[model samples]
Target: MNDTYKMMIVDDEFEIREGLNSFYWERFQFQVVGLAANGKQALDLMQRSDVDIVLTDIKMPIMDGIELSRAISVHYPHVKIVILSGYKEFSYARDALQAGVSEYLLKPVDLKHLGESMMKLKHLLDTERQSSQKLQSYENQLANSLPAARDHFFQSLLEDLLPEYHEAKEKMSLLEIEMNATYYCCAAVKIQWRDQPDGSLTDANKLAKATTIIERHLEASQCHSYTLKRKAGELAIFLNLNATTVSPRKSLSLLFDHIIVAIEGELGGRSIIGLGEVYQSLLSFPDSYKQARSIMERHIFRERSGLFQWDPADSLHMERKEYPYSVETKLLDAVLEGNSGNSTMYFQHFWDSCGLDSEHAELPLVLRYLTPLFTMLERRLDLHGASFETMANLHMPFTEYVEQFQTLSQLKIALDRLISDITLHIRKLNDVVQTTSHSAVQQVKKYIEEHSSEKITLNQMADLVYLNPSYFSIQFKKETGINFIDYLKYCRMEKAKELLRRIDLKVYEIGELVGYQDRKYFATTFKSYTKLTPLEYRQSFITY
Candidate 1:
């Protein structure tokens, strides 16, 4: 809050030092904080006081003004210096300037010139202070936003959205993420609380305690690791392991064993962890994450809480099957007709058609079959001008909703209740005409326009408006007369064309700026859209 600068005067003559110090320095917005008989004393004063400006003579007993200026430049660079010399030699001025003096004033110092130089230094100091404050503020904001940014980046990485390895690495560097190893693996942890009586620890408290334990153990492991708290009581950890690590699997197992014991023993909870296979490259991280998540979801069927490591030989091998679209259609038709009996029958038939048996069905595999049905039902509800939430009360994603049930019977009961609710809503809205809102479509279009230079996907847009991806695709085409993918392409190409007019940017640089990381692919797509290559288009602009 103090706008007055602190000034220190250093000289061998007691009269000169007192004479200058006695002057009304306060009128110049400065306070005479120190009067040093020599440069050495001035440097000592600087170490104790916050001296802003120093006025010193070139010749002193212990240390000269030039020596003092050099010392301040090294130790306190922010402090400004003004050299006052009786010798008007160019060499004296040159030495003072080379030592980082702000200004040099001759002896019999002119009061007006001194005042002017002091004010000028004050203005310069104010500017530097303001710049430093702004830089500090920016740094604070960056620190506050870093966690969310890191989460988003890691989410994208786990989803395999950042396909370019080099780009991903660059982002990691910018975000200050370090993974200093040649191999990586992923693990998922889920904590299930035991029944607690009144006044017991809350679930959030339990989770926090468990997270502290996990993080402490992770830090002790001395391997590069990051923990993502995906949701309540759930964590995903990515570990970077050195190639020289002796049996990474054994090391991880021991580490997680300690974590599991600490959480259960201290928090009165059970923990389940699933470890994925290690890979040599970060590009395979998504594969590892998927494997970890799949194995973790199988904990619902397990009899005990422990670490489950992915074994390539013992992994469940299920042949991939096409979605039963015909059965789903029948179920959707039954719901639309408000035929409760047929809807129930068709829902059961749909389940049967997915080739899932209650005894041997894995949770992930079961959800995979159920996801398409849920999407179909959501689309049907959207078309009928009905809110999906009103029908099913599913406030979360279908996959998460399905994970709550521990048994096949419980899951079946939940699905049946959902179907009943859907049929009931259908009967209630029998007289309502089928309609779709253009608001969600318009929002997606606006987002595409604004973020054409970023990676955009139909699923991301659909998630933005809480719609099924398939339904969103159909609605987008119905509203815009172009499919979602083509619309995205159109937006990117339009941006690319606009960037082509800028002569300063190279072709590859422009391509990267417009969300195309691969120059060849950008060129091919640009030619396909505009009937000319990017360089050719730019040359045409120059020619015109």
Candidate 2:
């Protein structure tokens, strides 16, 4: 609460003004900062002073309390008004109340009543100030989180997660992304260090610096651009071009030329940019991104650092060949069924189906064919609550997996090993499901109860119970008549309710104890679960 509130005294009579000013306003945690004879003078004084409350007489010369109150209500709605008047007319009090007067006291004001009114106004001011502070804190937090949120939105957009135009438009507006262009283009930029290692601070600093340089150049260009860090040493730049532009392709090419030159000449590092064609609708952004990524992947064969634009004619050879989807499906089924031998056989069959020989498939045609296959396998693992990290000890960005092998035979061997590892992991999971099917669900429930305050994931729980995520989900639901996600939410909400009983714990601190890192999200979830916000719930428990 604020220690002192500044107040103004407005009255035509000098005696009334002086007497009120002489009183011990400090006792009520207020200070009389100004004295005005009328409403006009009061308004003038208010402009010069920071007044929190205004005590004015109803009938005064030039301007009156009602007019002053209305003016304050219009210009300074936060300022509390107390009316002191000799007139006892019901109309005077009615007009005063309508004009936003906080309290109306007659001619001979009671000292006790005045003191009480001051206390009440002070409490209201304090509460409003606290609410304002909380709102400002939330705004600051939202501001800090906007960058990460924007990155996530762009990633989802590139992945074609927001399928509907309206949904994508809503998200873009929420993220403050202003992509108001008739044409859209995507470019994938990969930064390779000439000397430094991948994960060093120098790598990050250089990448950030390179991004800054690129942004500066883009800002100077005619088109609108947005840059997102796709992965380590990789950036995705989305361009919004005007329909009136003569040659969007040539414009983007020239921009990339400057960007590449700046990185290579200034940072002594190599940069490869893959430019995609412009599209009319934002829904086609994923197609543009795919094209750009496809061009970027070709860098593995060329081993060059420069700008590469997508050419429709260049892909004709690969487009004519039939993709071995049947072999891929067989391999995926074998892995999921935990048959390592069949998985290996199917994987080899898939490789041979690609029409590859013992010599390295260094051609871009073979890469274009194999890349989508590996991407599909990765996606399949993800769907089954598995990852390349756990199964094959491989980190993401899939390109790293391909770069590990120099020849087609080596890639085949590595992929076979991955298939073997995945099948073995799945076999173990199936064995556990057979042995402790019922107790595994109980074990997961107990784990959730004990570890609700920690980060828990369905995949982690599935791994713990040694069952496939899909199977674990079905079994857990059958045992408890509730899904794993709901059960986890129930445990967390129950814990939050219990913590809200403690007067010492702040709402955010309670949220943290209940495993919600974001305070706003916690409050929202809490209100949705319990029909009360964290603060409201706590207040309900208090004994007045």
Candidate 3:
């Protein structure tokens, strides 16, 4: 990994961008130099700074992460971007991916996961940088020109028309493409605009113009080829070569960067690029090019506009899996009815079916699939008048949250917290009715103040109000803007606070008087509500 890499953070929220800077990014091989309020400012800052990595929020003003990422991918191809997003941008993951974002992190950023992603990017940057440096050291004799013969030779090689290795060398010498390097890599670019402006130039003519512009960006000599395919295609290229010090892929990727911008800037519009890996011989050319094209095809299906590189290690394509509607409805039913136990059980079954329980579940795939469930929950919670803090808790896990869980069991534990919370809210609502009499609500409130030290229940309050527990629950919330249990707890804690004003009563006595047997638990609850322990609360003021 690069040890002295510089990083910039872009977000609409000041605290988030500042929090990223506050973390020890330097420990993860990054130096935070500039902070921008939005993507537009980030881009301007990028031009003036020597930054290597960017951590940007997806939905910034003026320019969003998608648009910013697309610009960076085309203009500063070497710079890696990591997206910081909330649930609203979950659907944009594929779009962000197309824009060449290195990673996507959910909001309430977890520094540990952020560190892991940054370090991984560091290794990538270091490798590419080292390779680029090595390529420059090879020192070409003079810029050489790639002619039509070289293009024909490459086409023959890709088509397996070339005969033997010895004959291949003869062809390389004949075409002036034999370099001193021993290794080879191939890169291919395809341009299919999402929206192309109507123009007089034919697709062939457009490809030809792009090809000519591309030629000006490539090295003239020793070992590069260029071809404009006017028939049966957009761009079908095969690179078969030896692995050596030449670093052909880096050069190709660089040329690709230039051509991408030129085409998008000059031609119709946005396009997708697929880069293939290096192989040692002609036998592997077919496989490498096919892999590159396959990756590009997937990107096209995703409707993203960015460079898609082939990873030789993983050739398996992701399968799209849908959650069963039957199981989904069962969980939703449990949630609405406030059945925490049943909801958890149904969700567990559904999660297992998603194959996310496997020991090796991919985070992005699991997150992408689970995003919808989270959005649905948040929207429902909003309709119920939950506090903002509670909603934030709901967002934590589904967003690219803490990466601490190595197993599905651990992840489930975190999810269970969210499930229980929603169920709890619904249960609170289940016990009251909004249309109940105001005097009845006041009677319940007075009873809560009088008997808060005793164990209280919604049934007891409903008995006093002469209504069903469910109706009382809704009416209580409507009249007082809080559920019965919460109102009771508030009364108990307030009474405990008032008792602390008297110096003679011990903390344990105060706890028992407040209907808590465990003094420790009492202190914990007190601290949560008042931000002070019983002793601390008592010590803060002199008892007169």
Q: Write the per-residue lDDT of candidate 1 for residues 1-544, one digit (tens) a residue.
A: 2488889999889999999989888776889999998888987777678888999998888888899999888667678999888998889889888888999999889989988998899889888888868755765575567678879888887765633333355456445466647778999989889888775788888888888888789878766677888888888888887755478888888989988888878887788898988876665577677778888898745656799987666554633443455567668766765779989998898888776746578887898789757765676576556766876777647888888988887888889888888887776665332254388888988988887656566668878987665456556766888767667778888888887875546788677556665565577678868999998998888631
Q: List TM-scores for all candidates, in order.
A: 0.56, 0.53, 0.28
Candidate 1 matches the true fold with a TM-score of 0.56
Candidate 2 global TM-score: 0.53
Angstrom error of the Cα, residue 102, model 2: value is: 1.3
Top candidate on lDDT is 2
Please give the range of 10 consecutive residues that has the lowest summed lDDT in model 2.
162-171
RMSD of candidate 2 to the truth, in angstroms, is 15.1
lDDT of 1: 0.77
Which candidate would rank higher by TM-score, 1 or 3? 1
For model 1, what is the alpha-carbon lDDT of residue 538? 88
Angstrom error at residue 143, model 2:
3.8
* Ordered list by TM-score, greatest first: 1, 2, 3
Off by over 4 Å in 3: 1-152, 176-180, 193-198, 220-223, 228-233, 238-255, 280-284, 316-544
- 296-365, model 2: which lDDT tens digit per residue? 8888445557899988667754343345555666676667657788888887787776777548456575
Of 1 and 2, the candidate ranking higher by lDDT: 2
